[model samples]
Target: MAREVDPKKTRKALRRLKRARKKIEDSEKSDTLSDWEDEFLGSVEDRLETFGSAFNDPEKGHLDEALSGLQTAKLREIERKAAGKARKPMSRGKGFKSSFKRKGSGPRVRDINEDIEEETPEADEIPEAAAEPSRPSGPPKLRVVKGDKGDT
Candidate 1:
């Protein structure tokens, strides 16, 4: 069964479709579109003429919407091409997720503390006094805990 559509939305979509058609036609006068692009425009116009919308799948768009999200995106792309823009290839974002964030994507900066640590000694550094370094029986920095509870 055909989904019911709003007449107002249908009229708006038709106007947009006509505008897209005009854009393609105007572009052809200066630079020609690929055979597929021309066919795509023709097919879209035909579909819109035959049916209220270009797409039949309800999941592709809302019942009242003339174009689906993807359809609108493609239309925009077509319009860009009509404006003589090059067809740039789609690329994945430089991220693990779509909305990923980070400090930067450039070369990593050296930590200031690393240079300081190399120049000086750290508390964690093993003493060179030991001829052979062995795991001591006690913690590295032994301290006596003196408290009222007689922990000392």
Candidate 2:
């Protein structure tokens, strides 16, 4: 025989559960809890533990550990989002095609050829008399004389 559940008792229990959940949600938003709230949460945790979920224990510092882990994960996600935003989308299609001629091409080639012609003397042209050596003109040339150490 199935024992029939009392609808009134079930409704009252459901309302109480809803109220507790609301309180917890409000506490989470405020990020502060009074002693009574702590005691209430501890009792809820004990009830949850009986069901084998083993929710975070404030006395064991598990709350801080969980909070730190959550904060780190949130920071990492924020960093990832920021990095994603920072990247620019790659340009598609042909992109910027410069109309200017490259080096050694077009007018530059003509300028280079003219420069080369100006620098080089024609083979048939008679060269001017070679200039006097600049160094020997400044000072007497030094000659190295090797002598036996014993003679020195």
Which candidate tops TM-score? 1
Across residues 57-100, which tens digit of lDDT does each residue of candidate 2 receive?
44542331222234334333333333333434555856454654
Supply the TM-score for candidate 2: 0.20
In model 1, residue pairs whose N, Cα or C atoms come closer than 3 Å (at least 3 residues apart or on different chains), thus clashing, are: none
Task: Provide the lDDT at 133 for model 2.
Answer: 44
Query: How high is the lDDT of residue 13 in model 1?
Result: 66
Q: Give lDDT: candidate 1, residue 119.
A: 58
Error of 2 at 115 (Å): 99
Task: Summing lDDT over every window of 10 consecutive residues in candidate 2, give the lowest-scoring window.
Answer: 63-72
What's the true lDDT of residue 116 in model 2?
62
Query: Each prediction's TM-score against the native?
Result: 0.56, 0.20
